[model samples]
Target: MVNRYLPFFQGVVLNQATPTHHPIPGNGNVAVNFDDEPPLLEELDIDTGLIWRKAVSILHPLRSVDPSLHAEADLSGPALILLSLAFFQLLAGKLHFGIVLGWATAASVFLYFISSMLLSPGRGGRGDLSLYRCASLLGYSIMSMTIFSAVSLFLPRGGGLIFAVGMGFVLWSTRVCSRLLVACSGHGDGHRGIVAYPCFLVFMLFSLLVIF
Candidate 1:
């Protein structure tokens, strides 16, 4: 089952990168093999790199009172605390399913970021996964907010609720499918390595079924 919203997700990822990286195709609907490293330049991708830089810029001063101390150190506890507070702020006004779904989505995003942290090969004292994890969570938060905001603008009241429920199911289904694809490949290569793509495609189909 092909993703009904594949184009949409691609659009989101692409909005952050350059036109040269326009067609950011995945293995159909399957989870990408973690072992198969991306190209050196596109590894972090332009979108992710800009985001990383901006976050570091904002984080540096807050993390250290000492002007001599670098921004890298501030990304730890101080960063996490700021992140948690931001989540609280976003949840402050509207504290219902929106909050629940927001946090759940964030938790799953953290899982992805943690996986990357373990997998990525960064150098120096700046290899703090926490910052990346926060970024991942923030990404999800933005996506969710944009989605619901759009829903409120275009969708009817009752229709919006139903659509929101469907969206939630689809999101959960995708996460499950991603996990299953990862499990099936068994962390190997050769013919078995390419299996993740097909598995992900199958999961994508399953997601459509769950969504519709």
Candidate 2:
């Protein structure tokens, strides 16, 4: 019966571990799985020196083509951008925190499929951008929309100006995201517009959220 539930036990069992790491065990060769141990503070890679520089760089689409802009795979910068977005939306009397995170995740997965799977090998864009990298890139890319959301709080409702500004920020995000995809994934500049389209749509969705 324990054999039938062995997988469940394995899932929860902590690795008290063996005698090699402790005094010699009286029991038969002590068996343990150390996978569940909480990481120590020293063991954690608490390095966050890059978050500020990377966040600042993300605000500039011109730097998007520079591979160095995305040298690290990080979610901290994106988390900050997302939190700011939620804050702005909250100020605008629309609490869309859940929708923002969900859509960001969906958009990341969608772009990952596009860049990592849909592009033919001949097109030179396949399997180069991992889902984690795509998520990180898009998370940073959304900073433009985050800014737009903040600006939108002061703008009048039902005006072309808001729409125009939203479109501009959407373009900004598209430029940064698409260029990063090309630069980081080694895709040719020729396919940049193709990548930009989906990115444009992703940003446009966020912009529309800002508009309404």
Question: Which residue pairs collide, candidate 2?
Answer: none
lDDT, candidate 2, 47-102, per-residue tens: 45677767787766555445586867778778889989988999999989999999
Question: Which stretches in model 1 have alpha-carbon errors above 4 Å?
Answer: 1-131, 134-141, 160-212
Number of clashes in model 1? 5
Q: Which residue pairs collide in model 1, if any?
A: 1-205, 29-200, 30-200, 30-201, 63-74
- Candidate 1 positional error at 115, Å: 3.6
Model 1 per-residue lDDT tens digits across residues 62-146: 2311211222222233233334434543443333344434543454454445434432334111333344443333333232233
lDDT of each: 0.37, 0.81
